[model samples]
Target chain A: MSSSGITPITKSVTPIPASATVVEAARLIEAEQSTLPVVDEAGRVLGVVDSASLLKALVPRYLEQLSHTGFIRQDPAGLLRHALQAAQQPVCDVVQTLPEYLQEGASEAHAAELFLHTGVLAIPVVDADGGLVGVVRRVDLVVALATD
Target chain B: MAELLAVGVFVLAIALIATERLHRTVVALTGGAFVILIGLIEQEPAIAAVDWAVLGLLAGMMILVWGAQQTGIFTWLAVAVGRASGGRPAMLVLGLTGSTALLSAFLDNVTTVLLVVPVTLVLADTLDIDAAPLVVAEVIASNIGGAATLIGDPPNIIIGSAANLGFVDFLVHVGPPAVLGYAAAMTWLYVRHGRQLVPEKERLEALASLDPTAGLGPRRDVVIVLACTGLTILGFFVHGLFHLEPATVAMSGAALFLLVGRPDVETALEGIEWTTLFFFGGLFVMVGALEANGTLERVAEALRDVTGGNRTAEVLGIAWTAAIASGLVDNIPFTAAMVPVVRDLSAEGSDVTWWSLSLGACYGGNLTLIGASANLVAAGALNRANRPLSFVSFMKYGIPATMISMAIGSLWLLLLLAVE
Candidate 1:
């Protein structure tokens, strides 16, 4: 894939298992400061969970349908309790399924389209069997274009 | 013979739509193209067949509703109703479902339910009660409330435009039945689920602590949208007096909002349910072909023969048939096919067929999970909230609601016929 241009940094990111708790996934992201791919036992990617998805998980799921949240006010203690309860669910439940992903040997333009279309933090680069080859972070794609 | 072929294709499409084997829009569009492609009628007549006025009205209202929706006013109203209910189970149920009916009276039922169901699911969660009952009631109320006004439901819109009826016409003929049906539906709901809606004391306290106005958008946008909504409804009422169609009134409101609201033109236009409008377009062409071939007149004559040509029997028969057919299939296509037949059945210049069809079709939408778009939309919302309402489960409530509404509508039609 890099033959055409800069490719995903395979060594920089960490992968989280599909069965991991939302708390575990959040911690992994905090420690890595990168998007985490949720993978099954065979190392196939299910979807990616990132800070945005994690933030979504912390609130009531109904918030997804609501147009505004400015009115939702809770005491910190109560809100923390709610978030903790929310974080205990399996991370798979909150994973944002990647619709447009980069395949092995795909060009950088495909990567840019996924970023532009989904506005996702990262686009997973998968192999033929849907194994996680790597992810191209939004920053990496932008910087590659800027400096190319 | 080509008319028979056209009829066959249209029936096959409706069956496919009823089964949901394909997207209704796709099926409708295909059916339309097949009839014309095979020369069922010429291109010019097919173009003439599509009711551009009804499509215009639907599109305009969609933009207007979305503009108001952006103000977060519906959400705010729903929340405010919940807060005002004092978390009392009876009051809460009544308030939530009642507000849904009120909203459906002005906006289309789908938009009404889309806004109300989410708030209901959230409120149910906060109060720790089952949301299913509340949602079912709201959906049923949506159909009934939609029947009372010309702009409230698609079936009524098609009926009004086809028959040259107006907003005031529907309110005079169907509004009373709608109010009675709402009462009957609410009573049935209370009787069936009253014992189960009890929220925990602690949850009630938590709910009370939340502010109802918290979700409101900017004050300015809310005021403007509300004023426009009021004006749109007002325009619908008097448009006939000014020699205007309802479509013109709705489009004018939409244009005014676009000019003043300054919402992204793209976003505002995006709110239109293009698939539905297109589906109506295709269905209209197919129905027009049927009308051109006198298929609808045959249907009308056969229907009249069944009722022995008595005006009272004719009115009640059309009403009940429209209800059952609408319940079994999606109401839009059924109403589309029936409009011409209703026109044919109208004897000596009476408008009773129009009102009966409107009331029966709208009431019938409460009969099954597949009966109306609003019901299906609510089911999807509930399923998303992990509170799935199945087809059978819906019918347990739906059957009685339909029966009650139908009974009321039939009697009201009969009473009107007797009086006149």
Candidate 2:
């Protein structure tokens, strides 16, 4: 069985637009799934956004400079205000542009390889033209392997 | 031809080390091997030149410090000082600087700074202040403090071993000047940067909330390590009376700790900085090659001509020249090269010039970020914590600190010479 057999790309899977705000993307991910594909106007897959990416986007840029040092707790009121301000940024600004994706015609073995290498729970499946096709999740790969 | 080749290689090694484009140990070891390969020095002499006392002292002290670190005693002591300051930023800085200087006088400056700077940074964060000034102050203080004792700085260790000076001799001669220089440096730091470290209300609250005693390790380990360190220091005092070397005292302490503490010997040994040990080994051989040839004698002759047998001129000249040279290069290698030259300048029993060289070389390290191993290690720790201390920024503080400290050192030396 190839990746096409395990892809969950029915008509209900709607890709988020690049122009959407981070809150909009987050709401969509919350409503549908943890992972959402970000597509440009021409239906080309631009990147992927997930709950983890959204949380990362809400963090102040300066905090990245604190390499290896653990996070310092801020006042809750200030942290909420900062996070709310970050929620208005464009999804494209916070999306993981280099996310791992699988081609629709790829095999289940290839899907397993990508999952192991990237350590991601789910990977977006794209067409040959790089259009959003579907997603292959870890659970889907596990079912496919079990049946094989 | 062999002498020329050896000198060329030595120069190249120093150039590489100054440029910092490569690791210093690699360059030093390569230069040492090249000198031997070209027949400037043979195998046995090179082996004999390694200064095993300095290496043994370094290794043993490293083991002792490493074991003590596992007990978290250094952090506890620093935090206790911070608490005593009552969250006042200036007092905290003064206390930390003073503590670092005192600890550095007995310990390796690099290890002393390594243990102290991190705690200082945490304290600075609690105070919600920039740590750059405080960290830089500690770096300078550590170098100065190390100058006061025979085993404090590597150059002092080399000087003590080479000149056969005892621990008490260094304490009596160099200790007073080091204390005066420390006072001058701390005064300058407060005058220049004290106002910038004022703690905000929220920062003061945060500082008050910190539990200084929370991180102190097991009580048994603390007691054992503290006892070991105390006895080791005491041993340094009486080692001369017993006709024992400092290395013997240090290694015995280290061995006793290892036996009692029962820390994994393999893991504890791994903490020893073998690279630094090897660097010392290689540098000694390279300097040995220079001595094997007549190159050191030529340098000495040139210096003698310049001084014209004027004792005052010779004393001041050696001190100031060493300060400037140490600022530009690693003081260890500079001290290594100057040791022979200083010997040639003075008679066997006269140790005035040796003290001058030690004071200048030790204090000269405060001139630049790259001047000493301690400064570089502190800077590296700062960089790792994402508080990047730029070289130019450090020089703004370093240049004045060096000038004031070196001036005090010179005056002290001159006064000592006059009295004698």
Candidate 3:
């Protein structure tokens, strides 16, 4: 078989349980090349929670108050307040979706497509059972291409 | 007056769906809700015309499909086919596409493709082709095959229920054309990718290494799922031919399958695409609004004015229009909305024109990338597996395959209508 210049890379994935604290999330993100890990607790992937998800999670009584006003604060202090509040929130509070999650795959092409479509710099590749396998990043592809 | 507003809303919904700007089911359900609201105010037949039987049929079929998938029966079949073909790249394509087409006629094409694509990718890696052509062939074949049965494609389901058409009706009217189209698809693949076939020994090795277990189930699971599918297909035909409602037959089949297998009810329910059902409901309401607003009547009148009530001219016009419209829009809504229009035209003179519209709408999806829900679902499944099927990539086969099918459909209709 002919090999292409694009070699599938595997490394630096960050995963946490949905119950992990914001400090834990921030540490994992900082440790793992600054990319968010897909979180799960008790073997179920709750969506990936990055800084954005963490911020969303911080807002108390999100579902209780359906008014749009809570979502529309623009002051820097208000944004900081939201972020700080989000930091206190549980990972489940800011989950991206339901039982069936949209995730990346182990294939190089799969990684590239996810990156292109979702605009994520890196994506968490999962096994068929939804366990974290590894991470594929833009830099990985770029490096592989450059060496080739 | 209010009807016009509903129609404008419906058109906007169609545009959003066709452009892939939102989930189709969402768009459809929104349209259905709007129509229901309008119906409450206008107090028209919109509510009466909603056809809960069709909705029930769709819901039951979806659950049946989910049961089959849960068992990994389809995945096992794809693996068996790949092994039987010895993984020769060309034979693999023929086997996978042929089998996919056959299954798609009874089961959902998306489920069929989802099962087949991963196996094909493994086979492709073994034979060492780009895998794109094989993927493309399977999708096109799935679409064509699904066109032959009343319950095969989504648009067919809508058309069948709306027209009170049955399984035998589809087989008599659309089956022959579908066969011809499948043959053409094989030929197309042969010309495009035949040279890429590898050695028999290498092919055998590739076949041996193939493991379809990525989503496989227990042996008991497989047996029960296959039995359920077999019964459902049988029920679809029996119910259709014997004057039983298709919805009744489908729901009965689903209840039996679930009861006998004793699968997880919660998982099966979750697996059902509720959003899609909502979308269908929405589309019904939107179409209802159009019907109430006189938009369909106005269009029918315009067509009558053009054709001078000549049935042949009208049939030809409706067929080609359906084909063209399907290329640019989601054929389910387009065909569903057109059902009454075609019916009125047929009533104005002869009933042959409705069949033409049915054929056009059903088969016309082969004309473009976004033509049918089956096409989109297949494309989405493959793309999820790391192989994105682009519009240009799909049209490479879709355009030609559609032309051939439409031509054959026209000729077959001419013969059928003329002889009888």
Q: Highest DockQ: which candidate?
A: 1
The TM-score values for the models, in the order shown, are 0.92, 0.80, 0.72
Worst window of 10 by summed lDDT in candidate 3 chain B:
B198-207
- Which candidate ranks first by lDDT, i.e. highest? 1
Off by over 4 Å in 3: A1-148, B35-44, B196-203, B211-216, B240-242, B347-351, B378-388
- lDDT per residue for candidate 2 within B83-162, as digits (tens), equals 57877766887889999999999888988887888767666756767778889999999999999999999989999999
Judged by whole-model lDDT over C-alpha atoms, candidate 1 comes out at 0.85
Every candidate's DockQ is 0.38, 0.11, 0.02
Pick the winner on DockQ between candidates 1 and 2. 1
Q: Stretches of candidate 1 above 4 Å error?
A: A1-4, A12-14, A54-61, A75-94, A99-110, A124-130, A133-135, A140-148
Model 1 residue B42 CA deviation in Å: 1.4
- Per-residue C-alpha lDDT of model 3 across residues B1-420, encoded as one tens digit per residue: 676687778789889988888888877776667667756324356567677877888888888888877666666667667767775666677788889989888866766666666656555545545566777778778877888888877777877787788887887777888888788767876776676655445345545655556446677877887787788778777785678888888888788888988988998878777876777776777777788777888889999999998767888888899989988898878887898788777653344676687778867777787887667766665554345789887888788878877888788778767875
In CAPRI terms, model 1 is classed as acceptable
lDDT of 3 by residue, A56-97 (tens): 454332222221122122222222444475575556555554
Comparing 1 and 2 by lDDT, which wins?
1
